[model samples]
Target: MIDVHMDPQVLAGLQEVMEGEYPRLLDTFLHDSEERVKALRTARGDTQALRQIAHSFKGSSGNLGAVRLALLCQRLEMASAGDIGGLVDQIDREFAVVRAMYEGELRRVFVG
Candidate 1:
């Protein structure tokens, strides 16, 4: 089965490379993602701002192997107006799923 929410291989590589800092990376990613989503809400109606935010968010999401979220962000970046609000909502929804997965992983890592 292909998991569109994330790429486990990229995450595994991150774990191998980050060692003790992996957890911290996850924490930071969640926090930053929240902020980005907030920015998206405020940047509505400003197409350029939306594109820039989506571009930056896409890079971070891609770096973290958030495959689906990154693709949504890419779509936002390329969006020339039209249903910006709906796209932002979609991105937010995808982030929620990704956030849940990361939070679950964190709990297991810390609790087990």
Candidate 2:
């Protein structure tokens, strides 16, 4: 089976430290990730820019326990050295999954 998208232990630890700010933290990650993805999509032939964005994004995703997303970002970062175009679609799809999962998590934590 695939590993869980967001690590429960990490989330629990974050909640313990962040308390009521946990939801805001999630919201900030979601918003910033969305912008990073958008910039990645539009970066086109700018390999240096793509690599920089992917590098930063990978760290944040990993911190948030989105291991798969971080892996995808790593791939994109590496691919930026060569054929970044070929990886764009895959990155977009994986990010869609990540976005949906995080949105669900946000609703669960903040609304439910």
Candidate 3:
């Protein structure tokens, strides 16, 4: 798993655009994440839907500075073209990380 760093440089760039809008952005990410997860779950027998949902997830994560998650999603998206049975656990784990990160960031911005 790639270490998704919320380094100064990365956060600086995200902060530049996010600014006081972090909460909204975080909400968007959360909504998108949930939607993607649901799509992925229901897409078990549909390879195309799986690929598309993964791709969409990758885009959303990238937009939120989640490079690692985006990469994982991209990998899953590509792997969906083949057999996805073996990748389920890994994908679920990564998705958990992404969800936690998003939630944590949101909490920091809103509660701190």
Number of the top-ranking candidate, with lDDT as the measure:
1
Off by over 4 Å in 3: 5-8, 80-82
What 10-residue stretch in candidate 1 is worst by lDDT? Answer: 103-112
Candidate 3 lDDT at 90 equals: 60
lDDT of 2 by residue, 1-112 (tens): 2355677788778878998899899889989988988898899679989988989989998999888778777888888356787666656777788788878878888775
Off by over 4 Å in 1: 1-3
Which tens-of-lDDT digit does each residue in 1-39 have in candidate 1?
225998889888998899888889989999999999999
RMSD of 2: 2.1
TM accuracy, model 2: 0.87
The lDDT-based order of candidates, best leading, equals 1, 2, 3
lDDT of predicted model 1 = 0.90
Per-model CA lDDT versus the true structure? 0.90, 0.81, 0.72
Residue pairs clashing in model 3 are none
- Per-prediction CA RMSD (Å): 2.0, 2.1, 2.3
In model 2, which regions exceed 4 Å deviation? 1-4, 80-82
The candidate with the higher lDDT, 1 or 3, is 1
TM-score of each model, in listed order = 0.93, 0.87, 0.81
